[model samples]
Target: MIGLILAIILFNFIAFKTNRRHTQNSILHIWLFTIAFQLIFDTMIEFKYHGYWYFDKEVDWLGLLAHTLLIPPVNMIFLNWYPLQGRLRSRILYTLIWVAAIMGYELLTLLPEPWGYFHYGWWNLWYAAILDPFLFYILIKFYRWIRSLEERI
Candidate 1:
């Protein structure tokens, strides 16, 4: 659980410290959206199909910590630094870099019990590498939509 605790602290610290683009309202929206989105996906992958799970393969508070606190800040960091106005090549490259970093982080989460909090069933790093871009695409689209709504208000 130490790994999970450290990640929650570091990711949230960096997210709040480094973010300059989003307003307070937008950050709140993004935080809630990320948590809800992750819950939906996790319900299927972690519970239904048992693709993978955090801490354990059953519903627990530690897994909730991983879902709510650990990931949304990372999403915040991702959207905060995303090259929104970059050319297509740069945007794609940026996404690729984030994907690689996420994959590496996933590997770290798989280390062991006290240090590592992640577990695999039928899932693998390749699966994450393949799916992360699409997940990021959805997140970007959602953020764009949120911005559009905010602009009109």
Candidate 2:
């Protein structure tokens, strides 16, 4: 968690310094996609672990919400920091990074003996494996849409 936070900060710093051409709309769209993805995935995990019932625990709920919101912004920061020149290259890099990060997180979760909020169930692993490609495709499509809109203006 600490490492993730630090990485986000560092990425943001570099992105802001270098990617001055990035528009607010681009950033917002990226953030929206990220938040939506996190919310969906986290909700699924929560349901699998804690059943259909929701919790009144403010801390847990807030933490989940906060992380969901943070996902896109952090992702945007990294993507902007290393802005890809071509669509194909961007999509490939995006897919690779997302997969790598998810795998690393899963590994960390498994390493500390049930230290993570979500367990390494077969379903969860399968979900994670499938989600990366889906997210990459969605992000690429969305990014192209945004670029087209920008060109029209």
Highest-TM-score candidate: 1
The global C-alpha lDDT for each of the candidates, from Candidate 1 onward, is 0.93, 0.58
lDDT score, candidate 2, position 130: 71
Model 2 scores a C-alpha lDDT of 0.58
RMSD of each: 0.7, 4.8
Over the stretch 1-153, how does candidate 2's per-residue lDDT look in tens digits? 444344446556765567655698887777777777766765665554542221222236535644554456546655554444668777577677878776776555443322333344334555666777776666667777887899899
What tens digits encode model 1's per-residue C-alpha lDDT throughout 1-153?
A: 999999999999999999999988889988899899999999999999999998889999989998899888999999999988889999899999999999999999999979899999999999999999999999999999999999999
lDDT of 1 at 41: 94
Candidate no. 1 TM-score: 0.98
Model 1 clash pairs are none
For each candidate, what TM-score against the reference? Answer: 0.98, 0.62
| Native-to-model Cα distance after best TM-score fit, residue 32 in candidate 1, in Å | 1.1
Instruction: Write out the backbone clash pairs for model 2.
Output: none
Consecutive 10-residue window with the lowest summed lDDT within model 1? 22-31
Candidate 2, residue 94: Cα displacement in angstroms equals 5.6
Candidate 2 C-alpha RMSD relative to the actual structure: 4.8
